[model samples]
Target: MVKKSVRNKAISSVLGTVIVLAITIALGGLLYAYSQGMFSNLTQNTNINVQAKIIVNPSTNDSYLQLTLVNNGNLGINITKVTIDSNGISIPINVYLPPGQQYSNTFPLTSKMIAGETYTVTVYGNSNNKPVVETMNVLASTV
Candidate 1:
């Protein structure tokens, strides 16, 4: 029988190892990039809480809309505008609130509100140079 040639065995083994190492490095890079984006988004989330109600004054039988805003995020936010959907009214405001702080105010309603009725209030603002909106459904009640 003719002798088997082994001259190319070492070269083949080296080539195969290089290909596997290249593939492993490429996969590792992709995994690292994906994880970086996920962590960044988690750290940059915004959280704002809103509470609203229609308050009726017992003494005068007058009605008003009350709003309470709480900033629970890591950045400060500015209250730029507010809208009462039922009355088709928009109120422009400029209020700055820092994290862990709150702001509350009451606005007189043009018309009286019926008790047990629901109303919609929308608040618009900016936080960290990004627009933010919070909508709340409020029920009319007497104090």
Candidate 2:
């Protein structure tokens, strides 16, 4: 009878340890999954795409600077200004673009554009109160 009681106590002790270990592993896995989702939601970013070109009118030979802005992020961006390197001029404008949307407009250039010349155009904007700037180099072409 003494030997049988000892054997039963040993079995119960082993079963209790197994149950605690299993519970610990399951809790650890659940915590890892929850933290992954929480951190991903906190780390979001804004992305803006910029494109520019010098468009020359075929009939009148007048050149104009065309700008195309695209918001490819999950946020909205407000365009505040644009600067052209060829003339060293900055134009102030107010334009708002939502996510997955595009804005395109042409501005008249005071100076004539020479074909095959490259120009640098810079765009300034804000998204979520953060300043954003995008610059692109484009060749002058007639259209």
Candidate 3:
């Protein structure tokens, strides 16, 4: 009777261990699946990037400041406003561009561009109620 009892106890101990291990594995798998589903529902927001260039068109005799803006990102942009700043004065312009597109505008200058002066251009856009801003600096031509 003593040997039979010992054998039963050993069998029960092994069976308990196997059940615990199986439960642990099942729980782990469920947790992994739940986490994957949760992550799959998450998404990344759209990003916008723009490149700008300023040049003096010789054909215009430096009377106009030409600006070239390019959208260089994967997302589309709905431009709302454009502004040029010189000596603290803000000039608003109406311009629009889409993704992977370019926009060029020439603004007439009342005075010649001074050497070493800095000019700022700001672009404001929107995407699904999100505001986007892009700024570029242009240095006055010394020539």
lDDT of 3 by residue, 1-143 (tens): 45654433355778999999999999999889877865433543444454444444445546446666666654566777655566443446555556567777666665555545677867787766778887878766532
Worst 10 residues of 1 by lDDT: 37-46
**Structure candidate 1, residue pairs in collision:** none
Task: Show where candidate 3 strays beyond 4 Å.
Answer: 1-63, 110-112
Q: CA lDDT of 25 in candidate 2?
A: 97
* Total backbone clashes of candidate 2, pairs 3 or more residues apart or in separate chains: 0
Per-prediction TM-score to the true structure, in the order listed = 0.65, 0.68, 0.50
For each candidate, what is the lDDT?
0.84, 0.84, 0.62
Clash pairs detected, candidate 3: none
Candidate 2, residues 20-130, lDDT tens digits: the string is 999999999988977876444356667888888888776887888888888887788999999878778687889999988999998988677777788888999998899
lDDT, candidate 1, 6-101, per-residue tens: 665355778999999999999999889878764443465557899888888778878887888898886889999888789786878899988889
TM-score of the candidate numbered 3? 0.50
Please give the lDDT score at residue 67 for candidate 2: 86
